[model samples]
Target: MSAQPAETASGFATEGFDPATATIVAVTYNRSHLLAGLLESIVRMDPKPGHVVVIDNASSDDTTQVVESFRDRLGAELVYRRLQENTGGSGGFSEGMRVAYELGSTWMWLMDDDVEVLPDGLARMGAWAPRFKSIQGRRYDYDGSEFYWQYRVSVPLGIPIPFAPAGFDDAGYRPMNSGCFEGMFIHRDVVRRIGLPDPRFFIYWDDTIYGWLASRVTRSAIVNEFVLKRTREIRQWDMGTRHLNASSNMYRYHIMRNRGIMAHYYRAHGAYRPVYFAIGTAATFVKEIIRLVFVERTVRGTSNLWRGLRDGARIRRDPSFRVMPPLEEAPS
Candidate 1:
């Protein structure tokens, strides 16, 4: 949150690569082409994963076709589970984690659909995870190549921090913004306690909320370059546009509604203020305006965000605008 130097993202592999790792679990609703590239890298891991699971969240495209193309090459080594409904990213990720749980993997690597694991992801993250355990409360470069620490409010480089640690190192461990997700290889035992990410967060911030919780139960903060993520991607697009286009309905519905929901906890009890949340709550409205007037000239998506905010202000239970299980593990 403080003014820090621009992050060094390019050299993460060499300066921070870790090569010893195990199974990885990823989710993809579509874009099997992109996923195939990631899966290919996983197979080449040094200590190959005992299992790799991909939960297809009802993708309309030839996603299954894409995955199947690689079946013979990866064998049962890669397991694919096609879903019946599109519950959203939270659901998709939860389903993948559930599969990882069933496999009894010591660790589960979490990856996004549009992201690619660095060539040395497994070995790098695996190696750093332990070395990280030694330092405790600190983050290492993806391949154990570099370490980044929070100086005042900004994170800067220290030395090369190993990706993983063999034993617990309570030195400077901090849970990630979203605890462990976004290409995180989680420990099995931790799952039994924490369960999967909160299913309520349908569109965004599920990770941030999860990190707050994880901080209470474990030390999980980290900065790794084990994977290269397309940080920005469209969940949907209107007739035409380069920017992500959301349904006028969902924008009004989930994105807007979830703002108040997240603020209730994140701001009130989770350390946020209503005023700040209000300012943030307005961002969606602003973006929608820009899209309508400048970027895409679309009124539908922006309108939906308004409707979502209206509904969100009424929410008191879980802030996210979603209908999911109260808090339960996905079926195995």
Candidate 2:
């Protein structure tokens, strides 16, 4: 774990700053080529992290080789672990963060392998470290245009509210109660306070629930100064409900199940009313039906929707869930 000191007026890091305390925890699966580009961007950061932990979700490709290729170029020590089984994105991050905290990291920067960080990304984020417990960096598509994640979770209705993206450019930091893990910067204490992200979610809504938990305990914001470029284009919302219809069976299952689980969480905690829960659940079911009839033009996917909602209703929280153990060395 290491970092070159930032160039400052005094030619040193801030008085008490120790770069070794920050670790970047990145998760990847099957996209070795994209992973290589992300590592390259990390190597170019003006103020790099002390260490980087890459969690591979049992990718059946040369992902390990991609990490090894960058060992000589990165200032931060690279710790790559390929999981024994595919545990999905939620599991990868859960394990990576646990390893980072155990390594004595005071801060953890979370991201996906599909992003290339700006050269000064960490440097700019480090400036706001004192003011917030967690900070989410801005993101742009491969084309260099900003990605608009305009909707935030409305906890009561268990739905999303469209927020205007207009005024954020002038604000140094925008306060946010929810979280997006892509380019998220968080202090170690917050992790200890809230616990690692839930892996049962498998993929969707895990970060959203985790982010909400963090905000409940301390401050979090979106920083507009730093940037991360997404390597892939998102076609998820291109054809209205067709997007949902086109998703893989696994994705469709989780998309529906996770919402029920999240709704269960909010309701159990008394954050919303029973009436709103009824409305939310009904709305979700109707939307799925619309996709099957109007977009997919087939009834085959309906079984997954029904099964997901059924399982989610009975899915109890696991308080003793442990993150997957880390590897002693990068795999060959």
Candidate 3:
């Protein structure tokens, strides 16, 4: 789809983009304290989001109460949905996007409860709406340093380009094929074309595939503008330029298991590389082993890698493991 320029009454030109047409979709699970901070940040936005959709993944805590407290303070409409069970970040985002789309939102700003949006973040992202449909804003690490996020995807290998440039170009933005859910600002039309994030991923790599799909249909890029700050801090291995955070056993399992699902996406997009993917998968297993032995100082979770590999192989062969199509195609 092509973007058309139009000027608003205030003389600001856009591709029919308006902040009032955007909806914030946040997925929270047992993090009321963090969720409250995120909501507070949204309330302070210069042009506050037109709507807020919070998907509570069956948290036993007071997540519902915290959301209600902001109803009066926030000027926008708030919709809260609590699931009966935890559906992981992927499922929550999928549900939240579905809800926001059903509400007729033109734009969806997706994020997690552990991060707080900057007051001018949405405005900076909106400036590029006249040019691109799938956009990602910058983020701050827990230590207040700039996060390393700019990179394109190696579809054949199903991994991000490790040696990609670190910063944006002279245009203040860089084209990207991978997507990060932390601060993804996308138009509804892109969602209509790419469909919701795959829930089967459960966690890891779902955003990358979604972003790749969006890039196939529109101009997808990540801008050099700080949009949010990560509130949660975890022990990380300093890799000179970047830091590799510690991962839980569950994360390790899903991260490996999801590679099988990723292969399915690669083949669907006509970029399948069996030998390269297998080599990459083996390298990942070795890396995880090193992290567990050196960084984590434990080998208790080593079985997760093998189990994940087994499950992934099964999923890759299953005919039912398919990409979800757009519910409604964009108007031609």
Candidate 4:
């Protein structure tokens, strides 16, 4: 990717005003390899964004230096922030938005660092910006790899479900409640109103909740005309604990607990949502019990199931399970 800046007029007649205003923020945690690949794609953006912020999630493995090396080359166009510890993508993006907003950004694009960006991703998104208040997301070459948890429904359940308006069906994705962080481009005004991604959800389904929140603030659409390629298995939550792994019982815990959170938020807020979460949780618990008893593979994973059961039984109060680092507000 080339870092050639588009020539903006310079002189007293041209007040350092930049008309091409958009910012893309990529969030990463220790995946310097993925971060470098995504950065190369940013350099190739045709109508490149005014800036890109790489929010490093406390990566211990040289990710800070990797991004710094890139910024040293890109200068003001690429700014990097290294947090003290990994806060998952939710915390990374929350802090990332804080950083992007300070840089005079008019719009923000949320993406994960471990991916290949579509050369025209931002340009096409910018083209559609005038049409809607927000764009949900789209990923390239998707064969259901990462995680496609479930379908989304806009408006509360008791209320009639609304259909996507004209002009979005061609994309082949339903215009639903929310979207993931993959390639969602957010207009700056919405962020000012809705605030950042909910950090209460440390790891699971936070995007779904965020998408629901985004819809309340603005009319949204899922755009797949362009896409990003991510090389991971997508949503590797409940990944069995192994050496050198950041395993958290929170994966199961959040699934169990967040179901209650969603239920309270939407059902009380009156979406008449399904108990599908409850059903899934119950089924998983039964399977875990069977595995532990029959297959006889008793490991920390069993404890994870126990955590899920405990949290699910009392899901109301178990909101955020993360320990925040002592860090300053995002730099202005």
Top-scoring candidate (TM-score) = 3
lDDT of 3 by residue, 81-120 (tens): 9999999999999999999999999889999999999877
Worst 10 residues of 3 by lDDT: 1-10
Tens digit of lDDT per residue, candidate 1, span 196-223? 7655666655544544444445556453
lDDT of 3 at 31: 98
The TM-score ranking, best first, is: 3, 2, 4, 1
The segments of candidate 4 whose C-alpha lies over 4 angstroms from its true place after superposition are 1-19, 72-76, 141-151, 154-173, 233-250, 267-302, 312-332
Clashing residue pairs in all predictions, respectively, total 52, 0, 0, 5
lDDT of 4: 0.61
- Pick the winner on lDDT between candidates 2 and 4: 2
Tell me how far the alpha carbon of residue 104 in candidate 3 is from the true structure, in angstroms, after superposition. 1.1
Positional deviation of 155 in candidate 3, in angstroms? Answer: 0.7
Per-residue alpha-carbon lDDT of model 4 for 118-203, expressed as tens digits? Answer: 66566556555666656755554334333232235533331112233323355544555676777777777777666677665666
Q: Candidate 2: what lDDT? A: 0.74
lDDT of 4 at 142: 32
Better of 1 and 3 by TM-score: 3
